[model samples]
Target chain A: MPIAITDPDDPRIEPYRAVRERDLVGRQHRFIAEGEVVLRVLLKQPRFEIESLLLAENRLDGLSDALEDLPPDVPVYTANRQVMDAIVGFPIHRGILAVARRAPLLPLEEFLTALPEDALVVGLVGLANHDNVGGIFRNAAAFGAQGVLLDHESCDPLYRKAIRVSVGGALVVPFTRAPSAEAMVQALQAASFEIIALSPAGSEILSRVKPARRTALLLGAEGPGLPRELLARSRTVSIPMSGGFDSLNVATTSGIALHHLTSQKDEKPLPR
Target chain B: MPIAITDPDDPRIEPYRAVRERDLVGRQHRFIAEGEVVLRVLLKQPRFEIESLLLAENRLDGLSDALEDLPPDVPVYTANRQVMDAIVGFPIHRGILAVARRAPLLPLEEFLTALPEDALVVGLVGLANHDNVGGIFRNAAAFGAQGVLLDHESCDPLYRKAIRVSVGGALVVPFTRAPSAEAMVQALQAASFEIIALSPAGSEILSRVKPARRTALLLGAEGPGLPRELLARSRTVSIPMSGGFDSLNVATTSGIALHHLTSQKDEKPLPR
Candidate 1:
């Protein structure tokens, strides 16, 4: 199915091109992880549905070894450097990019019920940056947080930049878009899980987080941290910072908090 | 005094032009943080020395107020949009662009001794992205981390992108460039500060960290965490995570770890 495009204005590349238009960029509800290195990482996922792959005449990597799962039928469009530059609107060094459709949103109930008896669902609220979200996922995957839940205003977790930032951790981590903060909080409470809001205005320190059967950390963006309302609704657990400097990125906050909550089973409790 | 040039190739603006180079573009050490908005931030710092300023004809916010500082001494150049655009490689937004010499690197001793006793110093290892570094500073400032210190491999804390990502915190938070990790570790030990390395490899949880007289939470870049030698020299305290997920980002880890260590002052022993 490989289709050659002598013209950069080919209609076949609308979805990919639309990624750059301001309005469609972040709000796509899907991600465009348009790079060779990252697409290879996505290929590892069983559910990866690569819509299209555009590459230059000179092959990028060990395309033979990296993309074995491609059933010969998938399109591997070939073009010269100039054509690719025109097509992608930028010179992508690695020279191959695949437009990956967002995986179907996982069901919350299934994810909720799937957690072990004790679980900590790290919830991301207002985490708008795709790269930040992806980085958080990467850290989340590395540290073994049970799952990540995006709040109402969050950037799409599966967005392309996030995929690249997470270095493909976006594929492995079990994350779902949670409902409104109120609804998500209620659900966590209904399930008998404690909702620990990681905040700068926390009443207790993060290490002092006394885990119950389950815990869910509510993370807001780095600047305007968890909205005041979200903080008010949940039990606040602050990470005491000794440096006089203000603020850490939300992704970074989520990572430390996730690690803190997860480590409870093995050692002495940290400060709350 | 003001100087105006219609040519973008004018050697007079070499400092500004050098900023456009690949390694230095959008960088802290050389990037010219143009605009009244960004320059106003630079003016507050005793550190950011103004090299030159190009002002567009119109009156701007803070511009009306800064005339006193502009005395007959400083260079204030002027050009309309078209002319300024010709001189600058890109459209000069914010009407005003100030070219300032980067603050000289403060010695580790100067940064450490300048702080009041028991001050929190954030030592970063291998965190490269300017934005991430900037965001780390923002969070560090928010949580009152005393000062941020970058080891040799870290990005410059003053880059334009870092400044933007920090939301201006880069201009405010006090930071030092300590190029040697070993030297930094030695400095901390000399300060009688206990360096707590945050990681997932250890059994000790974050809550297990006993509040010390002076603490430095040494953080490494994501993916490859702190080197074994560094970890070996420091007390290892980890944030617990559910089995099989990845760890948190170095900046976020610093935030939570700093929060964990800073929260309570009670020396009461916790129950095992």
Candidate 2:
């Protein structure tokens, strides 16, 4: 049964208070899932445990279907729009927010070993922007890429804005952060994954490169690109662009690269 | 000679004051170009006139080549970091900002008529988000699409943030706003361009479809997608995706769609 909460000061609702001051996800293992769309994605994933739900009274009716299936012990707290705003310290237009605890993170080596022999993966280096991280995960999920590997310099995928930008892809796609770009590359090489570094100066154009059975695309931060040593060690490729234009955004680059590498001959859509 | 101003409230710099309170771009025919990269692009574009440049004292030395080529009448203003922040109402971290006036927008019909016989173009419907609009233009430029036709409901591509997000592609690509999506579709058909409507429910897969000599992709806003009437009138195409995943971001969708449709058999980079 859904709980009716009238007080904005209710201790049970404390986790959601003043979200802008500091992200609850960073401070604790609990992360916020905003909007009905993200909450729905969270409901479907078993890896995360739903801590509770805080919903506007007006929004409850619209999300009855999602609420009905939630485990009985999971508390569904409802507040009027004003009280909800007061509790959260701002207007949350989405009106539906869920707090969920993150599952145990997989180590880089262990995660690499689990992939299938012909799996497609993306490796990100020095990608400090949260939105880019989330966008990459969303793209990864769309094309059925197995997982992503992030170096230490990358932003946390579970950051609140990243999760919202990805439409909850940060929750669905499997990812692990490594100590450094060098370490991440070494692990993939040991796992027998072909490393193709994407660079503006890369000799091979993206369209012409044929991926090996197990392939990992190496992407770097928007401006600096991949470190020279990394690019030199791997097979380097570039997206052919019209002359005089800057390179694509980091996330957009991943989408284009993944689309080419993951698309099969005869061009059939990958099964979920 | 560069004009040096130490006072934050100088009437000479009034056009740049309190940028966050009200965007000067929307208020007037003017827009802002931020950072070194965008400024460089703006310099190359003949259409947008550089009204004035506000550069931090530290940055002027590095931009010697750009400043050398500027017309003598165009004022180059230099300020210290603190004074620069006071003028723009923000940190102005990139240390480079320029004010540029938009060129007169071409009429929708006239712009469409101007494209080459074999040109590829993109038509956007009800895309109100500036980032998405900017991103689409960036992708369009990458593949050498001739121009974009936006409906009345779309945001202005010349809006300040859109230009910055586009990395100034909004300046480079020729675009015009039409009164309605239906009207835009008719114009493309009249111009003898094959219209391909991209939709999640599209019947034909994008990869298998061979584009005509003159092809224009019609894309709608993310959630509602293209109107059924528009879809019926045009040949619909879908990007094959892994099942259970939501459709890609509209911008990412454009990038993938344009990449596949625009790549030539010989795989040469599209000429600018």
Candidate 3:
């Protein structure tokens, strides 16, 4: 049986409400996502923990077949549009929103050490936009970046808009937060990483920069780009430009540069 | 001598009003821009043809110096946020809205034939988003993609959001719409251009694919990626995942990919 949540203050929907409370601990704040597309993709994982589900009165009728397979009793809630909006901070028109938990991250040391030799690591400098981060993560998944390394000043990857923009790449991509970009650059250098900062000024062509097979691409935010300190520590590689152009969004730049550097075509032909 | 017309129906503002009018000759719609950043950039152009200028009282003060530069007798309109919103059909808090005559595009044949033998081109395929279009144009300049070519389905490169997202790349980068992706792809092939389709499913990794010195990269919108038919006609290439990732946004991807192909990594030791 589904419960009706007519009021915004309903404690039964606490996980969903946590995101609405801005004063909640930064990391403690949680987010909720609804929609068949998002749910359908995420539900494929058997280990997924869904705290609760809110489906429309009519919408939940066909989902019984799906509900029977759930390992957890996800308390279902129903409401009219007004009631639903009251319960969540925003409108819940996407039909279904699940209060899924954010996974605890692995320690940076373990995340780095356990990664495979060919693992591609993405570290940010000062990416501020959640949408950009999420989009970057989405691109990372689409092009095959292993996981992300969040640096100081970067936006929370699990923020609602970020998750929505990333199409859940923020959830899927393995990541850990790093202290300072400068410190991370040094740590990566110590790990034998070719810390290449994507920039507009540098002459080292991004495609031609031979990362020692173990490359860690350092991306900056949209506007100011990587600080001098970060760039000074890393190999400065640039995408070539023609007339009337400037630079690209950091995430897009990351995707193409990563593809060019890591793909096999640019490398020596192996003996077949 | 900026004159304020009390009527939204004022004929003096017809060009400005028609900006929202549909199918006003697909090529001749009045262009509208709101906000200081876009207005500032557009003002820098010597060829900007103003229809009417609307400025919030504060913005009027901010733009007084630039406003004086406009030819005397150019019509000016003043309004507060409420009045501006009533006229614009949307809330525009930027306190500035400017209308201009659409700048005509350079003839495609003329543009193409004027190029040098080694001319670099930014060939776009089915890029549906105006923002992405503008952004790619911006990145094109930053990464050196020079002139841009758009497929038919692309939103007008000069669309409002496209111009905003491009940060004025539309004004700087020379772009023209191709009749079809097919015709353009053939023309590129005829030119001995190595037409590379950027895709996740590309058989050869981006790093491994040795593109011909003169190249055209075909990119489609996110999600759908490059079409299979288009892929059949061109060399399929992919950016290697940096972190076992998926793909980047079209503009970001283009920026990096173009950077790779265009960078001055000359003296690259010939492959063994």
Which 10 residues in a row give candidate 1 chain A its minimum summed lDDT? A18-27
DockQ for candidate 1, please give it: 0.44
* Deviation in Å, model 1, residue A96 alpha carbon: 4.1
The backbone clash count of each candidate, in order, is 53, 0, 40
Question: What TM-score, computed on C-alpha atoms, does each candidate reach?
Answer: 0.73, 0.93, 0.79
Question: Per-residue lDDT of B79-115 in model 2, one digit per residue for the tens?
Answer: 9999999899999899898888878878777888888
Cα interface RMSD of each candidate:
3.7, 1.2, 3.5
Candidate with the larger TM-score of 1 and 3: 3
Off by over 4 Å in 2: A265-272, B6-9, B265-272
**Model 2: which docking level applies?**
medium
Please write out the lDDT profile of model 1 over residues A11-108, one tens digit for every residue: 87665453456334454444566565567667776666777777777773557677677757667776788877877766767677776666676766
Candidate achieving the largest DockQ: 2
Q: Top lDDT: which candidate number? A: 2
Report how far residue A202 has shifted in candidate 3, in Å: 4.1
Q: Which model is ahead, 1 or 2, in terms of TM-score?
A: 2
Cα shift from native, residue B184, model 1 (Å): 3.8
Better of 1 and 2 by DockQ: 2
> What TM-score would you give candidate 2 relative to the actual structure?
0.93
